[model samples]
Target: MTFTDILREENDDVFQKIFSHPFVQGIGKGDVPKEALAHYIKADYEYLNAFMHIYGAAISKSGSREDIQYFNNQIDFVLNSEIHPHNNFCKHIGASYEELQGYPLPPTADHYVKHMMYHAHMGGLGEITGALLPCPWTYLEIGKELVKLYKPTVNHPFYHWITFYANEQVEETTLQMRKRLDDLASKASEKELEQMKIAFRKSCQLELAFWEMAYTCEEWPVRDYVKV
Candidate 1:
């Protein structure tokens, strides 16, 4: 099976569990608490900011000159145009470009970021591509369900914000990752290629767990804006 197919099948299992949860199901349906939603909004922005930085680092370290340029251009656009602007959910949550500088990301967030950097710094280009694909790709999968279940409305900034990353950006990134993977896989050692597949799958599971933790928690300082 193709990398995209493998990722989709693995993500489907995790997305179902997250979407089936009461907290996730309630979002955008008027059941979520405003405070919880607010927290999520802020956290999501912080997360995105960190994500851009980490991915930028990976792009910088890529072996392929083209990969480096692609990631750099994408990162520049996201930081300057897409994410920097104080509009939409970022505006509603008071997450300005300046505030993003001081935002404190979750520890687990660092794990993913650092992991990508490590692979990019030490591993082949294909390995770095594999490492980066799971998170955005999984988010895209979940975002589709959220859109389906909780049609976007003015009141639901949280869902709307996430949908942007999941729909528009993730597809483009996934396509780039597939191209990188295919190109590198030919030169990659058999063991290294297998490891990349395993790492991608494990990362997908972690993404699911992160959502499950957010939904199952009783009190989240960051997600308090959304009422459970």
Candidate 2:
């Protein structure tokens, strides 16, 4: 099986949890609290900023013009298509980007983004792709599946969020990234392949935690007890 297939099979439990998680199910039912979305939107903006940086890092680290070109395209997609909509979500939710950025990263969010950064800084193409792959790919899967279950109307609270990831643009980008990972895997050493598998599995775990964080509007558990 392919690395992603193997990784997904191994972490199938996490994937199932993510899809069934209350936060995601909330979107399906149009009953999700706005407060939860408020917390999520803020942290998500921060996450997107990190994602953009990793894409830029991927460009500089890329060995070929084709890879650099793809990274440039991905960055453009994030900025032009994705980020603007995120800002709109912030506006609708009434969370200022300034406020969100200034807030400390929640623990799950911190671990997830930091892992992507670590691989972007340390790993080559396949490893970085493995680290980055879980977000868009899994979201697209969830989004597509959610839309089917919810059949959300135009006015649904999370309709835009649902449709955005469920649509062709995200699907196209995800497949391209997977194809890139496959190509990288073809030439990678067995040790490198193992690292990629590790990255993919850990990333899947983080994705599940991200949803749990959203459901609870999680902050660092120890924040209230600080000695300072």
Candidate 3:
């Protein structure tokens, strides 16, 4: 099996949790609360920013033009292509995308971003791919399953969001990343492979946590400090 297959098999339990998360299910049903979805769109907008930064880190560490191009293409896709769904959400909910971009990362998103950033800054290309692959990969899987489960129509509130992640373009992008990760794994040292395993697993766990966070509208439990 390819390295990504191994990673998916190892992390299947977490993937299942992410699939079954109420927040995700709500999207499938076209019934998630507008407030919850507004929170999610805002949080995800921030998450995509961090995701692009990791791609930048990957580009910096790339040893070949092809690798740099791959990362660059992904960065462009996230920056331009992914925003439409979020913009649609904002319009429906009357939320300002400008203000949404200004919101702070909630605790789970903060931790997840830091986790990927640490690997991006400190690890080799293989490890960076491992850390970053889960986001798009899982989203593709979730979107595909949601479409099958709900058979969403154009009238569905989240049809754009659901179909965006479920489409051929996303599937193609995910396949490219998986092939890239597998190629890197083939050349990696045993220690690097282990690091990749840990990064992949941790990312899957955090993916699940992100769903839970959105479902609950997660916020900091206590103020970091009181006003002077």
Candidate 4:
């Protein structure tokens, strides 16, 4: 089996929890609250912005012209398609870019972005790929399953989000990343492989936390939330 397959097998339990999480299930059912979704969209925009930074790091770390082009193309896609559309969606739902920009990063979001940036900046190309692959990969996988489970209604608040992930372009991005990762795995030592697995697993866990945070509208604890 490829390293991607192995990693999936090893982390199956984590993915299961993520798939079963009420936040994700709500997407399939269209039962998630608008307030919860607004929180999620704001937070997800942060995640994608961090992803663009990671792509820049990947572009620098790539050894080959093809690899550099791959990251560059992904950078374009995220900026033009993923992030802009997201910002528009947020606006459509009453969350302006200015408002979202001013919002403090929740603890869950802060941790996830730091983990991704740390690996992209500090690790090799392989490690960077391992760290960043889960975002596109997870969404594509989840999107496909949701498509099968339910045909999205035209007015479904999450239809745009659903279709974006389920579309071929996102899956193509994941495939390219997986190809690069498998090539790296071929030359990696067992210890290095273990480290990749750890990074991959941590990303999956963070994704679950991200969804849970949105589902619960979790906010950073401060004087506002704490009893004096």
| Clash totals, every prediction | 15, 0, 0, 0
Model 3 TM: 0.95
Tell me the tens digit of each residue's lDDT in model 4 across 1-228.
999988888888878888788978888887777788788877877777788898899888888999889899988988788864466357556677556653555789879999988888778888888888888888888888778888886687667777788899999889988988999989998877877887898998998899998888888777334334
- Candidate 2 lDDT, tens digit per residue, 1-228? 875666778878878888899988987776777777777877777887788899988998888898899998988888788864466456667677566564566789988999998988888878989988898888898989899898988888778878888999999999898888987898999999988988888899999998888778898767644545
lDDT of 3 by residue, 19-112 (tens): 8999899889887777787778778989999999999999999989998999999999999899878876887788778877757788999999
**Off by more than 4 A, model 3:** 224-228
* Model 2 TM-score, 2 decimals: 0.90
Please report, as a residue range, the 10-residue window in candidate 1 with the lowest summed lDDT: 217-226
Q: What is the C-alpha lDDT profile of model 1 across 142-165, one tens digit per residue?
A: 567778767776467564554665
Clash pairs detected, candidate 4: none
What TM-score would each prediction reach against the true structure? 0.70, 0.90, 0.95, 0.90
Alpha carbon deviation, residue 74, candidate 2 (Å): 1.2
What's the lDDT for all of these models?
Answer: 0.60, 0.83, 0.90, 0.81
Say which prediction, candidate 3 or candidate 4, comes out ahead on TM-score. 3
Query: Of the candidates numbered 1 and 2, which has the greater TM-score value?
Result: 2
How far does residue 75 in candidate 2 sit from its true spot (Å)?
1.3
Best by lDDT: 3
Every model's Cα RMSD, please? 5.9, 2.7, 1.7, 3.3
